[model samples]
Target chain A: MKIEKKDVEYIADLSRLELTGEEKELYSAQLGDILSWMDELNKADTSKVEPTAHILGLENVLRSDLPEPFPDREAILKLAPQRELDFIKVPKVIE
Target chain B: MNNFETVIGLEVHAQLNTATKMFCPCPQADYKAGANSAICPVCTGQPGTLPAANVKAVELGVKTGLALNCRVNEISIFARKNYFYPDLPKSYQVSQFDRPLCEAGSVEIDLKPSGSKTIRVARAHLEEDAGKSLHALGSRALDYTLVDFNRCGVPLIEIVSEPDISSADEAHAYLTELKRILQWAGVSQCDMEKGELRCDVNISLKAAAVKELGQKVEIKNLNSFKAVKDAINSEIARQTAMIERGETVAQDTRLWNEKEQKTVPMRSKEMAHDYRYFPEPDLVPLRIAAARLETAKNELGELPRARKTRFMKDFGLNNYDAGVLTSDRCLSAYFEACMKEAPPSAAEGEAKAVANLITGEFFARANELKVNPEDYLSKTISPVSLVKLAALTSAGKLSASAAKTVFAGSWGTGKTPEALMGELGLAQVSDSVQIEAWAREAIAANPDAAKDFKNGNEKALGPIVGMVMKKSGGKANPRLANEAIKKILAA
Candidate 1:
């Protein structure tokens, strides 16, 4: 489907985009061009071609019916943006 | 009373039984360990890493749908549900919207009022899971929430049911049966406590004429079955009160604040723009070949409801006992393994009584030991032992009360029930002479108690029987000993 200017703005808002009018209009046209390109691509002569979803075609990859070691507390806390003792710190929400 | 009907639907997210993460080779990991450790660039939505779909995850999704009586879609598409969250590394969750993997099935839930009712399964789709969110300073605990990426890109099968549930109880039943079926089909462990198996309920209350339906208020964060039930109950009351006050229940999501035991609005209702879903070009349509679907179907041993009924018919077990047995795949297998070892020929009531040991004594003992029975189930106990113990009680060789002691002793020492019985000299005497001799000794020693037994003070039969059992050193089965004592006293 072709992307309309209004639809682009709506999408931008959903995406939390903070754009000036000029940037919004610019992105609207760019996105519209991309959608039109996809539309053209849809018209390929290969009618028998199946759409692909996953990269690898392996089916039913499963873990053993056992629980392996979960990450330890130290390993998990290392990625926290801000940490004290061992927890991810976010802005204080409770008054 | 207002003539209103409640419409309830459920969306259950069951983590599939896969060895690897949904799109990567990271060990199908745990969520308890916080951020980044379980993550790879592919899952973290790194600038350039690509996701290779986990095919087995899709088969399980289809297999799950088939068990729920859903029709596996020929070509199912994956889409990106865009939302910005710290825990979601990609900032957009890859999901299915229009063409889900499976469609149009139903799950049968046991209704207390009626015998059984089938709730329509709207669809079940495959999706990638989000990462863990740890509240800082009890921040998320208190309001400040932080993200942990450990769970990101985990494969999940979202099973959504049609709005067929009329009450909260049916919703609860539907979740229960769905979890049991998924676990039994060897798809997922379905441990709700672990959040491996989780559920969110959508409930709306509308007047009888309001066929268009009222706004749906989705309830989330119900960890246990009891919590889910209570949330539904309280939500119904709250909705009813609002309706009575002539207020509208908005379309929004609410959290079941388990600690507070109340439902609170998580966010105001949002339009479709909230999570703008668009086709995901990274992945291709999931294909279901007829042979594969059939294979998956054959692989599914039995659904919970069907297995429960069959357990009663084939094993002569009761409904409650059968339900308990089939709640989880491993537990059911444990019961069957015990039966296989002790087959019905060896014990008349082994099937029913075996479950009692598993759900009762075994579970109780395992709890005391603080080890999950599932961890030791395959190794520690034998069905033959269970059957032998039950048979002893049945043949009047051991009393029911005595069987518990015998089982604990045998189980604790890892000795065979027969061995324990022999060593403890708990074997009951069936010999007429031996039984009579014990009874005669009891009569001579306890003349007053024996006379009371004859004079119709039937309660006095207790001490005389005790004397016979004591004379036999508690090895004699009390039932036969009592009978022998009664006969000898009468003569």
Candidate 2:
């Protein structure tokens, strides 16, 4: 599929990124090229192969449900950009 | 309005009652703790941190799926639902997308006045909970929102239903039954006040002449079951009015305003976030072993519906009594324990008596104390004590009113029913000599009532019995009083 300027703009909007007109055109072409190069996989005859999420072939890597509270929670909260008392503060989001 | 039909579907998010969060080892017990006190690097989405699935959460999800009559897929993949929100520090939520753990389930709900309908469940997928965002605190609005990560990373399962609910009452029944099942299976507490259970509603209208459904609207922020019902009704009215005015309703997301009793549009369809879902690479696919599935099925022993049916058939309880008793798992277990305390010969005969005691006096006291009836079973009143009280009332050793008095006295005192009855002077006077004298006095006082009773007006005996009970200070066995009054009138 061909990547167009509108497609690039939509992607930019979804990613919460700003793009200039020239950047949009340039990204569109670059994205088209990348897609075309990735399309080479379509030539392979792998129709019989089952799709897999991971190649490691491992499953059910789980932990028992036990509460091991991390010590020093204050250190974690200190990494916040802004703080109000014990809470992390951000601009209000009404919705 | 008569020609149009309302269609509704529900998406319920129930926080699993696991000891730890879904992915990380953070404690999930105390959401009420100080803000950000429960956070860790894994839950806060620190860079390069990986998540390990909680096995208990998976078992619970499978158990719930089996309870809902769903097929448990042997392998289910976790996906990342990408979004941008301050509450979601990961910028993407780890959830089940295309391959859910459970799918194609159905929940049966009882309709009013006695029919039943099955609401089809599309899927029940496991996910993680986001943090809490507080915009205002204690009537004071803040310029910036405060975020609490204590609730973050908590395990949640989203049960989605097909568009089968047709009315507001059906929606209410669906939620009630769903919550009951969840709680019965020990999957979640399903407490709306604690934010353990949350719901979102999708509704649409279809005209009689049109084959396609009207624009679907989603309503959110419904904190209670009543809010869910009221929101659906308000949306139905709004949509009906719009249709009557020949106006086309636009598809949008709305928030139910509890104060205004109306739904206000929160965002248009165009502004909807595109949650580009992809398989989560950090976690491996969950493969349910056959042994694990069997264990889950074993854990889900006797679902609410089955136990309710047994209560009706085995205990001779009516549908309403069975429904009330089986509504809570703890309450049902308490009832069973009371029954077990009964003698084998008297168990079946006394089942109804035990049920009445629980559904009547026990529940009434529970309400008065603002406590759960099941909570009082072992905490205050033991099952043996309650069963003995029922036996006393059944054997005519205590009158109904006297038994109620004994129950009130015995509550929270750890006193036996017989002891309370004697101490409170509320034991029934079963002696024929004493009852005959009281009956004779009552007959002498109420001559008109005695004459009417002699003339075969059985209703007139009520006054005579009332007088006898009064003379005996409510300690008279009412049945014996009635028999004495009839014998005196006959003489």
What's the CA error at residue B95 for candidate 2, in Å?
0.6
| Candidate closest to the true structure, highest lDDT | 2
User: Where is the poorest 10-residue window by lDDT in model 2 chain B?
Assistant: B266-275
Candidate 1 structure quality by residue, lDDT tens digits, B22-117 = 877666666555445666667767677776777678778878888888889877888999876666768899999988999999988899965989
Clash pairs, model 2 backbone: none
Docking class of 1: incorrect
In model 2, what is the error at residue B326, expressed in angstroms? Answer: 0.4
Best candidate according to TM-score: 2
Which parts of model 2 are misplaced by more than 4 Å?
A: B268-273, B343-349, B367-377, B408-427, B441-467, B470-474
What lDDT tens digits, residue by residue, belong to model 2 across residues A1-95? 59989999988987889999999999999999999987997788888997788778999999999899999888888898999888899987866
lDDT of residue B109 for candidate 1: 81
Model 1: lDDT equals: 0.76
Residue-level lDDT of model 2, residues B1-491, one tens digit each, is 78899999999999998999999998985756888878899999999999999999999999889999999999999999987788889988899999999999999999997899999999999999989999888799998899998888999999999999999899999999999999888899999999899999999999988899999999976879999999999999999999999999998899999999999998534345589899899999999999999998887889899999998988888898899999988889989888889887885668888898889888877887788654766665788888899999888989887887778777788899988877887788899999999999999999998888778898999998999999999888899999988887887
